[model samples]
Target: MMVAIAQERDRAAFARLFAHFAPKLKAYGMRAGADPHTAEEIAQEAMVAVWRKAASFNPAKASVSTWLFTIVRNKRIDMLRREGRPDLREEDFLHLEQPVETQDETYEANETGAVLADRIAGLPDDQALVIKKAFYEDKSHRAIAEELGLPLGTVKSRIRLALTRLKTTLPDS
Candidate 1:
């Protein structure tokens, strides 16, 4: 009957196949934990797959029942996977807002930054360079050592001395 449907587009063959397998497929879905509506949907989709894939079926591989059951199982898995995903909606995005700083906060931040830069400038050249690379340029101490061709210990010492001097001079935040 599958071969007949594949070769001739036989509606009678398909009707017989659907009639025999639809209820069984639906029951299989329910036994596997689907609700009645979902089971019915799975059965209908599986039968549609059978009709579309009839040309690809091989009797040597498995019987028709095995093939139909496999299609139904796959369709059930696909449905479950789709159901597990969260649906996106415009309302879900409406609550998120980008932070905006007020004018006083922005001025305070700029003033603090300027004070920090002035304190760093007061350090000796080597200590100031290390501090700038480590904090302003965002380089690691080891990377600063490599770039400056200084020993790792020398780079670390420079950063420590710079921080100690700045701490003594700067007011507590």
Candidate 2:
């Protein structure tokens, strides 16, 4: 019967399935402590999922009842959690992040970083020291000038010149 629904999308087969399982699912939800209306919704949701996922059902793995009750069981848990977690957003869970880094991106980052380091090293000592304080040490331009006993404009100029030289000198990968 499930195979009929999967192969043919037979409405009669679906109707028979619903007739057999819907009430039982509802009763199961209620026994699991969902309210009456929630139990009804759970049964309907489980049946819809079964109808849509019918093609995925494999008799080789599980009996029809076992597979179906599993759906009902999951739906019941979802309903229970829904009641408990009113703040849950469906959209928040719709997309999952792929955390794997591609080989190309990793290689490019390492190469670019090495080029940047070499470029910074090639800068004049005064410019390189100011740039290092402003960027690497996260010092403000005024603070860098005060600490080095130089004028603010001189510190800013050094940083600007250092950046322009690095940008023009670094190899674009």
Candidate 3:
């Protein structure tokens, strides 16, 4: 049914998929510790993902529910992170209310960023790899673990240890 929607743009199949799974996805998000609004967002995003990525679905590998709940889980994380995230403004970094009048300020900013990069480079290889993958590459810990074929706990431990090292190494700001 979902594959039909993907390949043929079948609204009825999509409707059926939405009717069956949106509520369940919402409930799953709530059980996973999201509030109602976030749960609704996750359900909505997951359904959209089902529509967009359904062509990739293969019934032989996994059922629609398996595929969809996976999408829901990821969507929940993304939505909650966004809701809690601060809006990053240029002023927040440059410490200026308006456009900079000096190029020296830009140079200083780049130099400070370089120093931070040096500190990251100083971490142990395992710790630095996890930090880069998680922050720079923007991959989930589970994705990192699978890519590296390491246990999830090992990946998490590396990230935690790396963070602790960074916290101690970087001067308090």
RMSD of each: 28.6, 22.3, 17.7
What's the lDDT for residue 5 in model 1? 79
- Provide the global lDDT of candidate 1 against the true structure: 0.69
Name the lDDT value of residue 171 in candidate 2.
35
Given candidate 3, what's the lDDT at residue 69?
47
Give the clashing pairs for model 3: none
Tens-place lDDT digits, model 2, residues 3-64: 78889999997897787678877877776667789889989999898888778766544445
lDDT of 2: 0.69
lDDT of 3 by residue, 12-73 (tens): 97987787678878877776567799788889888888888777765444434445645765
Q: Report the poorest 10 consecutive residues by lDDT, candidate 2.
A: 91-100
TM-score of 3: 0.46
| Runs with alpha carbons beyond 4 Å of true place in candidate 1 | 83-173
Residue-wise C-alpha lDDT for candidate 1, range 27-145, written one tens digit per residue: 77776567899889989998888888887765444446546656775677678555543433211132213232233322443465577778887889999988866643436799999
Residue 78 of model 3 has an lDDT of: 70
TM-score of each: 0.47, 0.47, 0.46
Steric collisions counted per model: 0, 0, 0
Instruction: Report lDDT per candidate.
Output: 0.69, 0.69, 0.67
Q: Model 3: residues >4 Å from true position, as ranges?
A: 82-173
